[model samples]
Target: MIRVLVVEFTRPDAAAVALGRFLRDEGVEVVHAGPVDTAEQILRTAEQEDPDAVVVLGAEPPSLPGFRVFTTAAEAAEWASGGRSHTADAPSDRAR
Candidate 1:
């Protein structure tokens, strides 16, 4: 199972919570860290959790090497659910 850490950097973290729930339903291990104040804190938490991916909501993701940063929860959920190839959802230009 894929492991992910959901971090909320802004107020009203409902989106982050929803993301965690969705990930859980998809059979992915979801770790939530909240009330995050700084980028350094995010990094520290990530190191401790050691998740495969980190989802940042309501803020820009910190530059963390070797870790995938997702700006939106939906994107993270899709990836966790094995839909990493976004192109699959894109409309085909050719009409068959």
Candidate 2:
């Protein structure tokens, strides 16, 4: 099974919770790193968890070498499932 470390840096963490649920539904192992204040903290946690990928919700993605950073759970799911074509069910992209 694919393992993912989810880092939520925003306040109101609802998006992260939703992403965790979505990933779990897709059969991915979700590791909640909780809300962090900096990218350094995320990197440190990633080192410990060593997940296949890292998903960041409600914040800009951090730069983690060897692990891909996905802004949306759907995109991460697709990547974890071997780059399958996405459908309309994908959550809307966050506005820039």
Which candidate gets the maximum TM-score versus the true structure? 1
- Residues 1-96, candidate 1, lDDT per residue (tens digit)? 467888987544789888888889988778899758788888899888877788988766678776788988778977888845322354222211
Error of 1 at 15 (Å): 0.7
lDDT of 2 by residue, 13-56 (tens): 67778778877887777899988888888889988886767888
Clashing pairs in 1: none
Give the candidate number with the greatest lDDT: 1
How much is 30 displaced in model 2, in angstroms?
0.7
TM-score per candidate, in order?
Answer: 0.80, 0.72
Off by over 4 Å in 2: 81-96
Q: Assess each prediction's global lDDT (C-alpha) against the native.
A: 0.77, 0.72
> What would you estimate as the lDDT of candidate 1?
0.77
**lDDT measured at residue 42 in model 2 versus the true structure, 0 to 100:** 83
